[model samples]
Target chain A: AVAAPAIAQSAPTIKWRLASSFPKSLDTIFAAAEVVAQHVKAATGGKFDIQIFAAGELVPGLGVLDAVKDGTVECCHTAGYYFIGKDPTFAFDAAIPFGLNSRQQNAWLWEGGGMELLRDFFKDYNIHNIPCGNTGTQMGGWYRKELKTLADLKGLKMRIGGLGGPVLARLGVVPQQIAAGDIYPALEKGTIDAVEWVGPYDDEKLGFNKVAKYYYYPGFWEGSAQLSLYINQKKFQELPKEYQQILEDACAYAHLEMQARYDIKNVNALRRLAAAGTQLRAFSKEVMSAANKEAFAMYDEYSAKNPKWKKIYEPWKKFRDDELLWFGVAEKSFDDFVHSTRGGKR
Target chain B: AVAAPAIAQSAPTIKWRLASSFPKSLDTIFAAAEVVAQHVKAATGGKFDIQIFAAGELVPGLGVLDAVKDGTVECCHTAGYYFIGKDPTFAFDAAIPFGLNSRQQNAWLWEGGGMELLRDFFKDYNIHNIPCGNTGTQMGGWYRKELKTLADLKGLKMRIGGLGGPVLARLGVVPQQIAAGDIYPALEKGTIDAVEWVGPYDDEKLGFNKVAKYYYYPGFWEGSAQLSLYINQKKFQELPKEYQQILEDACAYAHLEMQARYDIKNVNALRRLAAAGTQLRAFSKEVMSAANKEAFAMYDEYSAKNPKWKKIYEPWKKFRDDELLWFGVAEKSFDDFVHSTRGGKR
Candidate 1:
């Protein structure tokens, strides 16, 4: 009889399925999942393949975490903060209001002891997260009219999500959490005054710029909303060490590629949006100031009440603070001077 | 007879050597090469083992490019810009004076068609480049006394490298290319007034702070110095596709990890240096402004004289310009507001 173990070892073929919390139409955001899949297959010589299922095909879009947790799918590509209701600590893995940008977040997670803290926390949920994608800082929601002050935010009905919604609610705006597929129709019918999806690339695809002519800068909420490949802990541990390493590097490739894709596509989209008569706007000092203050207070409240939040927040806060200081010294100063000379918005 | 092709395919073990352009003592920088080697070996089940040689162990630190080109080593983990003396076009592969930051460089390479341009240029050297590492924005230098204006740079002796040294030469500063081992001694004996190595992490190791009390911000000339894994074209092509990919993914992993390591380590190092009476200083606006003007004019002159430089700089300039504008819009605004509240240096 042929030795079963030897045959399996020689030509090991493993198939994995990933459930995404996004539809296929949002190419830049959802294509990141496929980036991981393609890189995996290419790197492994077709020995390891990750078949991707768009939202609702295998599980509901927002149901990715549950699917992986329940072992329905081996993995998922999703924004971890989507499950903030389950555990507020999930926000750290993605983005929180007034949190780090793409570069800052990567520095924290990869260098600032973030991954280990997150790994231990995730272990409780039977998940292993590999950063797979990031939408560079998102655009603030499109507005029906240009808002000049914090007072303008009061009673403004908008479609926003996660921690941002709660923060905006404190500013007296009504934050409506709408499904992606339904946002445009709701906005067009005046059911909501505005909506925040992603940056220029994804938002342009959704045609939000068409209805809401005033496009804003800095989502401020999700400064680089990170998406991750969450693998079921049991399933991931069962793979050969080679496959595990290969899968991880593939995720790293996708993670870097996603930001690149967004940076280029968003630049072009913003240009096109401006040409198409979308007025670019900045959040006023008053609005941003109030939001920032409210956001920090909320974090403190969570730290006091939620044990998980308290445990992670202690370190997370320090990391974020230090990161801001460092970026101010180097990255920000150079960027500011360059921009001022080039006639950019100050 | 046994089937030769099948037997060859079943166990394809390949061992290679890498020449690193850094000493082993600088773990953060040098270990990036080892990261690629380790990840590749782990991903390939030790089928591809890459032995690493520190600077001067196999070839001199600055000899990595030649070693790969001449097939003395299969590859090198070195800063591409080190070969700028041979061709100014080489600067595009790494960082140039006042060039793109780490995130923007990654965007340009991965998305804005930078890799293709670099690959076309590298063809002349018979090498292929995989962006494998980065030292995020560096410190300007450690100065014996604080620099207040453009006048302060006149006849200042400093140990600097790459395009930065030449750019500084246009200013009143006299650039000194001291060996790393001798930099401390030179600084101690007042032979050199200042030294620019990497950031706090590496600078502290070299003990620049011991003699130089004033440490500066924003090594403006090198916003982000990227290091590449330069592979011999023939050797790369000869490998089975899977090994090639495993190596590529591993390099990407190192690329991501290197910056992460620097960001975190530099933070701690800076803290230590500050505590030890190292006065952190920002280059005055007048100084940064004058340097920026000089750098761009030099680029223009190079574009006129060098055909290779002209070919790449056109697109590179456009990409850099666009990147600056975009960052100004979002990333800078958020960072500026936060830093203002947190008391950042002007």
Candidate 2:
């Protein structure tokens, strides 16, 4: 048997409660919190434990940011955009329309000085944000009718999330902020003309295909939606340095896991959706082009109006542009070729 | 102040030595080992410490696999394809010519059953593998002269890494294997007509642009190269469960960190290279198509002769195809649109 070292004798036991903005039914997104908790607990020899509470268990889904900010829970898992009403800057922590994709988002936050900039911004809100998950590129919502042109989007009642609502609102879309559970019924009853939850896996679970015949490609608002862990600043500061490092590392682990889970799961889910006759349609270039123009205009206007948004937006935009140039050279050419010439007969 | 828990008293202290296949000057790749070590130490309050040794400090760079396998070192960070001379099957652990890109590779290993298959294979070598880093799709290589057609490759002497050599050999190219530090001198002196050494950041450090102005794109050979931590299975199983979990999570943290570092760093390096008059060229569609055909034929030949290769290649191929289909839809469409309409004039 091995002897316990002197260092272990000084390690403290602590417990934390994590509130998740997602329902347990959305396993891919919700599982990120579980992954963090599992790794943190296992690494700490159970000395540190985090109990998870699904949406509405501790607070309503949309209330998680405030719950974490006020220390109602020690931490919470949420998309930054969910709290955009508080400050449009929150969208940068998750995603904005026509922003970075999953890998590029990760590159921006982790290496392109985005974290440092955002950490400074988050100080005002009394929270610390760490990326915990990402839904690759989401499918555009299920449309009750095919949207073949920019004109088709006019007056469409869509249950969109976060800043996407405002961007869509520019294009004559009547954006409704319905809770996840309510989306199915709203779409079925024609109360909402369109809905986009996540990708194929999560959407299939919610049965959106049963109501909407046309499923779209590329949710422009969320080229990739990143989810974050928001820690109560005071509560986080109280933890031992070791525990703090463990928490950050655990979140990184979850971030990679969540993306991997979505990538593979979405592949099979999409194939199944296709087999069952879900009509997959790409947003026409006319719609995509117009949306692209509006998204940047929105960002430009925010830059002029909001100093906090401007601080992060300037660097973030440069990083995105640089990334696009580099990826265009090798990554795009390679992927386009390999994907076009898929290896299997299947 | 909080009191120490009884659980802390039972935690054991441990130390490990890590061998890296990269020189310290290659910070992005070498930093992965440091990232793992730093987190493991900080999270354990220095109770569990890991010391990193750069290439040749513990053993030669190419000898890391053997060092870890024989228990000469507790673990080592290196690319699996480096040992293909022992068995071509090792390529799956890193990259095969025209294989999955970085994200797809992570998805395959972590979620698409590739890890389980690889674990079973590694058991025979008495090692446990954990992904530590990935260099996203690499540049083809730097050439002294531009090659426009398949005929230009005939009898050309080039220094390439791992399985890429054999693939290139089929096109009448004579492949040279040279260490990273030696590649520049060889290219400068015209000892080799070309050399493919990673992407822009690392290549810039080597000053390849000064010697070879013709830099090619879409390294069809290494679409993405994954680096792994290979630990002695006996050493891993002997650790306390908590330490094992900590070590695994640390590798995952490093895995994400390394990729992000590359994604950001490469962007600036490429811009610098372009400004310095580095000629960026794409492999002709004719060349890309022929190389691609040869690559699949080679894989088919291996499957016909090698049972181990057959077992893994079949499933891996299917997963690759499914991924290609899924990515081609939304990811390709979104990225194509965004890149074509870059936000900045710069």
Candidate 3:
């Protein structure tokens, strides 16, 4: 009897380049791209490989999406909200002022159909997107002087990212979208009154505490900032089934790792910042309330005019409302009590 | 000058019970206490309270030490590595095998560390102790059945837990000490042939993929697993801290949540054993050979020299190391590759 023909299994090899909007100095953010490249190479047994380039390497930082959409590069790591100038609805893909926290974002994306909604949005730009990481709730910003009331925000110029700029502008504040490298000099030169980067870990490294005496809590603009990996839609579809799954799995692993690293690192940095006399303060009640009002108003205006924003915003807002109600009754009450008590010290 | 009279800030009140050990479900091994009292009541603006438990409820499942030691709780949620039976170091803390797997000895325990670890090993058991969970890691669990060479296992079974089990049992396989909940129950069971478990996320939940087939991973000697809540040395001191941090934190959060729940859920739960029939097998030639040799050799040598182990092992060894490490890199490489490939399949 003739032996059954042996099965042949071999995968095609492919190479691509990835550009990131972030600088290498921020390890967690920059590492997401590295993780994707590493996993894909290992899974395909060297059959497929991707090279990564940090911000400004092949294109200007904010120009990443344009480059990818135009086929200048194969993929890019970025926060979709950065391109809100093109379409305000893009902010929902990353974060919005006073929006969902990290866990909520994950729930919405993976289970609440947010991914599908966002993917549909991305088709316009010709990219296939996958969430790769999240920076949990972030600290407000750093200021040269303590913000005591609403009056303090008048004409205050600060460097901020995403749609937060416009919301703050409504509150009589001027917002600037400065790159990471340029932030330190601007703050040192007093060209800006304040700035909001990430939390303590990144802030400490940036030496913001030394330049800005008042560090505020609750970065209303980005309760939880989500990061995404944008692959050329056509290029992503070309990969074998297994290679694609590996990419997704790697992204999930990196997502968890980034959060864990930030949680641990932020605690130590916060303690250090406090010891350095960084003057931690809560955002003034007036400032907080005003900002919230303006944020919702802006959202309402966007929904009335932007069909894309309206489609996702309605369901997204409802989900957030329901989740808040449930957490308010249990998580909040428990956290408030334990955190307020001396016995709850971590 | 008049001294300003000191004013006390009233403490906030709150109540909560956390169930954990192995994230969520996986009962007996991690969810024992909820089986006790799920309702928790608190007064003083919801200040004082008492309720059910879970691993990491009051203390990290691994840190039942400081939690019980510092009066953070009146009880705890935990397993023995969890204290190491506290110093051959605390082997009797859980189970010993050629040891126990679930049924063999609810007979040995409830009668063993069930008493000994709490009495001799845990002299300060002023707190109540109980048998809350157990999973007999299936004997010589999960393996890749096509071992044509003994060298295949020069270092295998890399996913054991605790210091004693992994270190002592290094024959032809490398012993890995992972947490109970994470073992899979390792990649559907066959991912790593010969894993030890509290029993089923062991053989069942993790359904060794139809790929590997050999269901020889569970190390049987783990007959019965034991968990405990070590109370504070001092505040088991005060009649009440108000059921406050003590009773509220312990009984409500840790003590009763680990094992019993795991048992209830894991029973006869192997219906999905493998959509594809699984080949149940045993450890083979040269493979089992090298393990027995290395396990005992390491034990005897360590006992002869280390006073710590000598003090604990005289009685701890029957269940101590007799395992082996095989010489192969397939498990690690395969795992890394497979995980990376998961999301790619979409």
Candidate 4:
């Protein structure tokens, strides 16, 4: 259980550069990368330290994977969905339309076959993956107008997270792919009808509620958006076993902490949003039903055309379906009763 | 920032023993200490190694806190509620009747001032606590007879987690705190009428389904039972900053992972139990309501007598009540729709 004495005596320090898809302005999301860094440094007694780079500083936001794969940097913190255009299966690593929620996703990655399957896929790109952060189920979006019925989704013209865009499009919604910084201006100037960024914490900061009066949930598309750390395979393997595990444990800390912050922050931010006249809403059953059908249909199409997608989709569908049943019975049942009573207490 | 290189050059290794309240037979629960040890040693280059002693090896399972406080062991991995006889406030650290569920509990600790409040309380015992593991909402328990109404609970003999005992007692339950190993045989031989262990995973191992046909859920007392790593205060403070943070992060890793494993394992185990003719059931609405009512009343009683309980209880109730409202609207609404449709798909 011990390494060579000489290994400690030399005390060589390794410095790494970490690329993050999120800009520094989104502190809660971006801060997760720093959490990993701080914890790793503290664990290793400063023998290792990582410097974080914001989007476009060292590389463009979505280019994190490419940078890590090519060894441009030792690693990058990013959402896997950003690379979905390369292979739609990539979205499963982050979040997909109607995919598992945060608790279920963690179970999948840590226990069920998820980590093994995803690692096999990541191996092809010469990279390793660790869950680094999570933004809990997102808001549907901030809408300029209330979506009263199914027809409201027609030509919705909204900026959305990747995989859901296609699913939404099939339902007659005109989904827009806009840059993050430009979404506010686009919404403010009436170029788009709505936008979904994240949940209340980030949304409040983005001033989405100020411009758009109607706020909706659940984000149907992204149940639990997980951010990952992509490490170059060679560099990861070269680390001492303890250092490697420390990196992973550190990422796990950031992952759980990020979600905790959002869960806690969103409650008060949401209350503030409501007090400020932001109309909180839920998508109509009609809209939700149509979108659900489209999402599963798209999954079917991908399964038929792509063997890699087929391999993951078949099992993922089973995990998701089973989780839904179990959670529906206990989690949902308890929440329903407790929530109603909470209303009475208030 | 770097620690003294001379500190590393000395190659000094500090070995500490971790006492686990669980027996080796309960590997899933007992193994968390090993997980912490393996990770910590790796992070520190094997300079700090923790050897875990299962329950009864050094001291009795429930004596973990006392052992650590008296310096018999440097630390322990045990559930906080096990020490409730000493201070009822201890129940809040693990879980409480009608308390926060796993997600909310996590949010409370990492963000909602729970860690600070609990730490302040732990100070009186001259102990430091780090949340090390969690068992997600447990099975209400294994029942020999179906509970059809609140009246059925009169004089019911059941083995339950701590705080819930008082609540159940108020509603006519003869609460028996049985040893974990003795529970299976106690139920098998008709000594206890019902027993609530953890959920399906651990329950299956204990073979509860073989003897008790009816299985129930949403263990009202422990929505999430958090296992903590309790360190003697002086010893904890003596550690280097790097070592201190490593211990905390390692505990965090184990804490989140324990729940993930339970969430994943329970699904499969529940399936197996069902296949083996286990009569899966939900506690009747009447029973849940009485238990809920009694739980609150008990909390009020504790709040009146215990200063620590009162200080924490005031803020916790507000946090719990508010979270229920928010989760009810979004989380429950989404699950309700999605779960209903999953039935047809299967």
Tens-place lDDT digits, model 2, residues B166-212: 98899999999888878988998999999988999999999999999
TM-score of chain A of each: 0.96, 0.96, 0.94, 0.96
Question: Taking the candidates one at a time, how many backbone clashes does each contain?
Answer: 0, 0, 101, 0
Give the least accurate 10-residue stretch of model 4 chain A, judged by summed lDDT: A337-346
lDDT of 1 by residue, B262-307 (tens): 8778777888998899998888888887888888888999999999
| DockQ per model, Cα | 0.47, 0.55, 0.02, 0.54
Residue A209's lDDT in candidate 1? 83
lDDT of 2 by residue, A1-346 (tens): 2223433767677899999988999999999999999888887777788999999999998898888889889999999998888899999988898899999998888888989998899989899888898988888889999997899899999999978889889999999988887899999999999998889999999999999999998988888999999999999998887788888988988998899999999988888988898999989888988888888899999999999999999989888888988898888889878876764222
RMSD values, in order shown: 3.2, 2.9, 24.9, 1.9
- In candidate 3, what are the lDDT values of residues B164-223, reduced to their tens digit? 355435545567666655655464554455454434343465543443555553243343
Per candidate, chain B TM-score? 0.96, 0.96, 0.60, 0.96
Question: What order do you get sorting by lDDT, best first?
Answer: 2, 1, 4, 3
What is the fnat of candidate 2? 0.68
lDDT of 3 at A247: 64
- Find the 10 residues in a row with the least total lDDT in model 3 chain A: A1-10
lDDT tens readout by residue for model 4, B1-346: 4665343555456788999999887877887888899888877777778999999999999888889989889999988888889988999889887788788998898989999999999998889999888887777888999988888889999998779888899999999999987998999899999999888888899899888988877787877788889999998997877678778888878887888777777787888988899987787778788788888988888889988999999999988977776675556656666776665331
Q: What would the per-residue lDDT of candidate 1 be over residues A100-166, giving only the tens digit for each residue?
A: 8888788888888888888888998899989888887788979998898889899999999879988
TM-score of 2: 0.97
Task: Label model 2 with its docking quality class.
Answer: medium
